[model samples]
Target: MIFIHPTAEVSDKAKIGDGTKIWHHAQIRENAEIGENCNIGKGVYIDFGVKIGNNCKIQNYVSVYHGVVIEDDVFIGPSVTFTNDLYPRAFIWSEEKVSKTLIKKGASIGANSTLICGITIGKFALIGAGSVVTKDVPDYALVYGNPAKITCFVCECGRKLENFEDNKKDNLVKGICKFCKKEIFINKNNFKKWKK
Candidate 1:
């Protein structure tokens, strides 16, 4: 059974899975689908047509707008915002121009990050606090800054790899994760994750 706080407002058309908890002052719009065991924190606003999968946790004061799809085991920190439309037009026919964004499975965004429209954040990607994500982030990558640049790769255990002076293949500069004690190898072309 889902647990919705009395202060939260969940629309009749919204579908909340089992064991999901909507905390104080949260608002889930019509047609939104939140999966099982999800923790929705205080003052979250999930807009129409938004889809969130299992075991996701959204922290306080976040606004997840339309055209955003969140996969399983994702952690969205406090005050994180997801935007849909690039331009603002209240009474205009601009809804057709809205671009969708996808946050793949196991991705985590730190507090106060902003995800722009039309971007797909890859699986297990980590966005640091106060980042403004303007482009697609690769899987298992740790990114920071206003425009969001790849600083390094972080493991599931949450440790950044150390840099080695010799043997570049064994260094964190090459995007190896120390926490998981594994190497993350990417294809030669686009530097996308393949998990070596």
Candidate 2:
């Protein structure tokens, strides 16, 4: 059972899966495919041809532009903006100018963040509030700040992994969650570009 509010504008060409709920004044554009049990908050804008996977939660007034793909169980907080173009000119608009952004499964982006195009946000990565993500984020990374540097690695439960930063000397590091005691192995080479 999909519920689209009376004020929402969902195009007939869009494919929305079962149990999805679109809130008031949200706009789902043509060819956008949203998977099952997703919650699209009020005033959200999902651009044409964007694909969102199952059980995702998109908060109010978030703008998911064209060329962005969101995988399952992703959480996008309020007013998060996704950019599709590297260069912006008011008069210059073309599909060729659009760069793709991929948000891997189980990633959580904090409120008011801006994700630049052509970057892949890795699985279970946590992006802090008001961050400006300019490049690819490694899996299980906890990234924040302008240009979004990796501060540490986090567990799947969103808890900071113990001793991740202290053990960065090796090419491969093991991160253990203090709360959940789950071990996650991460390759430090993946973070070479953003290393401190």
Candidate 3:
């Protein structure tokens, strides 16, 4: 039961899973694989060979370039741009120069963000609007800003955690969500890697 809008250009070589809907003017390139029950909004561009997992929502005009892999339950907001090349020259382009990006399951990327290539966005991470993510983000991190830094850790429900404390013995940072009352733990080493 996949639905593709009449104005959308979906290549026959692309594989769209069941219950997916591609909206007006969207383009899904050759060999791209979009998993089940995904919503691709108007004017979105999914580049060749890109892989998107199940139940993802990609908002209008978002550009997912080649070599980007998005896991299940990801939310990519409007106008988000994913880059595949570290160096860009109009006349110098080759597939070998394309760097890969991995957005782990359950991550939310806010509107108008730009993600540089070769970075792995961790599971359940929340990226704020207008962010420019230049490096890897830790799991459950809340990141925002020009070079998106981890401000805090969030619960799986996307609620900010409170009463953050580090346990030196185990090298873990622990926080509890006020709303969900869920205990979240992040490895100290991984937290330190992106805390800047």
Task: Estimate, for each residue in 1-196, the C-alpha lDDT of model 2 and write its tens digit.
Answer: 9999999999999999999999999999999999999999999999999999999999999999999999999999999999999999999999999999999999999999999999999999999999999989999999999989999788999998876543556677777899999988787676454466
Q: Which tens-of-lDDT digit does each residue in 61-175 have in candidate 1? A: 9999989999999999999999887886777656697899999999999999999999999888899999999999977778889999888666665576554222355423344
lDDT of each: 0.86, 0.94, 0.96
For residues 95-133, could you state the per-residue lDDT of candidate 3 as single tens digits? Answer: 999999999999999999999999999999999999999
Arrange candidates by TM-score, descending. 3, 2, 1
| True lDDT of residue 103, candidate 2 | 99
What does the lDDT read for residue 152 in candidate 3?
A: 84
Candidate 2, residue 148: Cα displacement in angstroms equals 1.4
Please tell me which model should have the higher lDDT, number 2 or number 3. Answer: 3
Error of 1 at 175 (Å): 5.8
* TM-score against truth, every candidate: 0.87, 0.93, 0.95
Q: Flag the better candidate by TM-score, 1 or 2.
A: 2
After superposition, which runs of candidate 1 have C-alpha atoms over 4 Å from their true positions?
A: 162-176, 190-196
The candidate, 1 or 3, that scores higher on lDDT is: 3
